[model samples]
Target: MAKMRACRACHYLTTENMCPNCKSTNLSTSYTGIVVVLPGRKKGEDPRKGSYVASRLNIEKPGKYALKVR
Candidate 1:
């Protein structure tokens, strides 16, 4: 498996030299906590509508994001 790097700017994880989400080259190999946002919702509940972490992190796009980037 390839090592995944997390972008410092957007906190998006990728295996390339740059982040595909925000096109940021400032990536870090050392990071902690990973959050995966699902694209679907169960029943009538919205997934990201009032998510505490998502809103606090300022994540609009649904995908894998690092909680802390170093």
Candidate 2:
């Protein structure tokens, strides 16, 4: 199986050429770590503000995210 590609803009990982999360074509294969954000759990609180991992990655919405996209 091939590794998932991470979006450069949102760090969202996907197998498709176009990122489903940010709809960005800028994707990279060089990424490290993965984060799955659960819905209805951390509602109202911005992941880019409250959560340490999400904050560091600048993730605003709840979804699968790459810890580091390079």
Candidate 3:
């Protein structure tokens, strides 16, 4: 299995030490839950828009993301 790392900045999950989305060095090995965003039908709008997951998680980009970091 591949190792997982959570980004402190954006909660993005990746195997790399550095977060690909935010380029933040703050990474955590302990995290829970995962959320994925799909492309929105309208321009300049995200599919996750108005979703509690997006607002509570502070997610702006559409991709695989972690819910929490510990």
Best by TM-score: 1
Model 1 regions more than 4 Å off = 40-50
lDDT of 1 at 68: 93
* Reference-based lDDT, each prediction: 0.83, 0.82, 0.81
* Candidates arranged by lDDT, highest first: 1, 2, 3
Q: Which stretches of candidate 3 lie over 4 Å from their true place?
A: 47-50
Model 2: which ten-residue window has the lowest total lDDT? Answer: 38-47
- Residues 17-60, model 1: lDDT tens digits: 99998998999999999988655465544445757777778777
Comparing 1 and 2 on lDDT, the stronger one: 1
lDDT of 3 by residue, 28-52 (tens): 9989988886546676675457567
lDDT of 2 by residue, 1-70 (tens): 7679999998888899999987999999999989986553556667666577776766778888788889
| lDDT against true structure, model 2 | 0.82
Question: Could you tell me which 10 consecutive residues in candidate 1 have the lowest summed lDDT?
Answer: 39-48
Error of 3 at 61 (Å): 0.5
What's the lDDT for candidate 3?
0.81
